[model samples]
Target: MIKLMKSTFYKEEETKKALANFILEAEMLSMGEECKKFEYGFAQKQGRAHALYVSSGSMANLVLIQALLNLGRLHRGDRVAVSSLTWATNIMPLIQLGLVPVVLDCEKETLNISSQTLQSVKATDIQALFITNALGFSGDMEQIRKWCSENEIIMLEDNCESLGSQVSGIKLGNFGLASTFSTFVGHHFSTVEGGMICTDDEELYDMLLMVRAHGWDRNLSAEKQRVIRDKNGIGDFFSRYTFYDLAFNARPTEIGGFLGNRQLQYWDEIVSTRENNFKRFQNCIESNDDFLSLDVRHMDVVSNFAMPAVCRTHESFEKYRKRFENAQVEIRPIIAGDMTKQPFYKKYVTNESLCENADFIHKNGFYFPNNPELTEEEIALLCDLLHK
Candidate 1:
């Protein structure tokens, strides 16, 4: 049966070859040279100063939040504003650190954080904001960036779904102070299971690296550590084990890194194909506006087109889902839609009111096929079924 999301596994032999070389060259697989190489490649793609490979998208978010807290920008029980429609990982890291998660509503159009509601919410001691790029749609980054700047709030983009998406000329991940991405199966690219954190701040990047590997300085260059010690006038050997910061083991495997490195080479092509598929899906559904609704507002903001479509109501969604199922086409709901409905979230997140848009999407929105490898005829068939 066709599945809602499938991993793009092109050039399997090439990936296997790279994995074999990594295995032979680096006997120990935890954050080795291959991981370093992947980080560099990923950073270059995002046009950022640094990238730290992590075990998963969740871990990437966890490390970034922990690093922010270590920097004293956030304290235990401090409030962090986040979208109510995001994956649990997006908010869990905050709760895990004893930070209160203030769930915000999302825009029905973009399915990202609602900037209007964001401004209306009474500001408390919010140390940071965690925003997700819902289903590859680049959120209102310009507005969000300005809002964060004016308020002096730390911004972290949960870019796991919008890896290749861009607003104007700037990429989504680069818009925030620290952005996290997933290279898990069915993402824009895959390394079986992997994630990355990218940023231009060297201090933040270094903190991320330390946190990624158990608060150890083993990954730091001797000169770098020497400079830190020299500045503090500390003894060399004594500072080696001195855990100056709280950290965790979020390191990625060398094999995953190797796969990521290979996948990075084809990012542009993959993104382009996904965009084309999105246009095709839009065209197919445009005539059936009676039953379907497309949320894309502009063409300037490029979407990764990861899951491509959004239905307006639950009844229409069920009809389309059933039709697609009858036609053997697969579709699924958008990411964790309306996370407040989740039991775990109810226990962890605190908010006075629920987000109606997030709840609307949770029950109504679903995704259709957008695989690059799928032929035109196949896409058309799927679209026909969706509109039928």
Candidate 2:
């Protein structure tokens, strides 16, 4: 029977072995040198100047919002344009921080917030755009970046689903002011449960460090920490227990760090396998009139998080849903479906017309397993069931 995800970790044996070694020899289990090492390696890989480790991807998004607010890059009640086809946490932080969210529609072709959607907002009050590279599919980011710059809009990326994806030689996360990644169990990499925020902005990076902890100066560099302590008129001993700003305890453990380092070693193999599976899956459904698949051929690399299948009609959805279920394959709605349909959103969002495409996707779109661990035979069998 085919399943959505086989296990928590892609390379379970190797991951457990690494964790075991660290557990035996590690001096401390808290967020420390190991977390620092993992963060540095992740930053280098993503081509960012800094990376901050957190307990979960949800926390990564939350801390990023706080960091932006703390640095005055964004303010309370500012209108933040968000993808209507995003996860709950992506919008939750915006609401939690008292920011107004203007839900943007997704392109039917890419299933992402395309440049056209950005232009359709028509709201001049939009100070920021928090976009999600949904399920490894990205829109024309180069054009979007140019537009954001011209309009003075601060762009942030929720790249939790598109970690290894790239477009025209440029990485997706690099186009925005700051971007986030998740190493959740079913994600591209598995550190059990962990997340990262990457950015080139030095001041924003410093603030993120404090935001991940309890807004303490301890995580900051000695020079920076000293400056804050001196400015606050607090001595070294007293500053050790001081909380400087609004934040949360979202730090990851050493075990999570060790697993991340080990998982990164197999990065190429993992991505290549997922991409190959994606192509094979696409080939199987290209001729099937019942389904509509997004065109991702333009993407230089695609680290597919899941395979999205948009049924042409409600009848087709029921037919395919039954087939997959009978075959023991799992399925799920696309990224929590339309964000506006969520219970929490209904209370805050009144104008549903802005999310037309998102509403269409929510009604028609569903995703299935696209993990790297599937063998060629397994992939073929899964495709056969899908086509049947």
Candidate 3:
């Protein structure tokens, strides 16, 4: 049976052996050197000033929002626009933090919010945009970035699914003020369960470090810790236990850190294989009349996380879904289709307009595996099923 994820990490045997060795001699299992090294490497790879490792991608988003709020960049009741067809965690933080969320529709082809969608926001009250680079597919991000800048809107990305993807020669996570990444079992890289927040903004970076660790300066640099403590008039004894900001205990374990660094070594090969599989899947689906393919012309490199197939009709969706099931192929709905439909959103938000294209995707889109470990035979079988 073909599965959504064949292994936890690309080099599973190596990860297990390394972890086994670590279990024997490791002195500490909490956040430490391994986590620090992983953050540094991730920041360097993404061309960002800093990267903060956290417990999960959901925590990464929560940390980012809290940091921005702490820095006075966003305030209670501030309107934040979000792609309607994104993960629930991406929008939950807005409501949790007392920020207002305005749902924006994504284009049917890209499965991401377009520049046109940004322009369609008739209200001038929207202060920020949280765009999700869904399933490794992004809209014309450069265009969207320019528009956001002109409107004085802060743009952030939920790049959990598009870690290695790029557009117009820029990495997906780097196109915004800050972006979040996940390293769950099914993501581009696996740290078992870990996440990261990457940004070029030094202030935001500093805030993230504090927010991630029970809102303390413990994770901050020695020099930074000294400066902050001195400014707050707190002596060393009291400073040791001080909570400095609104935050949580979202720190990653040493194992997550060790695995993250190991995964980085194989990043290139992993992404390349996924991209190839995406192209093969695209070729098969493009020739069939019953499916609609994502528009990837604007993407310079696609680090495809999954192969999404938007059926032309609900009947077609059922037909393909049953075929994949009969063939023992695993399948999943595309992201968290139409975020407004979520119970959490329904409780907090009132009278949101229909995000038409997002709703279309919610009703019709489903995805199958595109993991790098897929064998040639598995690929041919998947493609043959798609062709039918």
Taking all chains together, the TM-score of candidate 1 against the true structure is: 0.92
Tens-place lDDT digits, model 2, residues 1-388: 7677777787787677767887999999998888899999988888999999899999999999998999888999898998888999999899999898888888877889878778777647799999999998899898888889889999999999988889998887889999999999989888889999999999999999999989999888899998999999999999989998889999999889888888877777888888888888887877787888677866898778898888888888889888888877888888766788788998876655457777777788788899988877778777887674
- Model 1 CA deviation exceeding 4 Å by range: 21-28, 230-240, 290-292, 298-301
Q: Which residue pairs in candidate 2 collide?
A: none
- Considering only N, C-alpha and C atoms within 3 Å, which residue pairs clash in candidate 1? none
lDDT of 1 by residue, 110-145 (tens): 778745768856655577788888787755688888
Model 2 alpha-carbon miss at residue 323, Å:
1.0
Provide the RMSD of all predictions against the true structure, rounded to 1 decimal.
2.2, 1.4, 1.1
Q: Is candidate 1 or candidate 2 better by TM-score?
A: 2
Check candidate 3 and list the clashing pairs: none
10 residues in a row with least lDDT, candidate 2 = 348-357
Relative to the true structure, candidate 2 reaches a TM of 0.97
- Which lDDT tens digits does candidate 3 get at residues 164-206? 8999899899999999999999999899898999998998999
For candidate 1, the clash count comes to: 0
Error of 1 at 19 (Å): 2.8
Candidate lDDT values, in order: 0.77, 0.86, 0.90
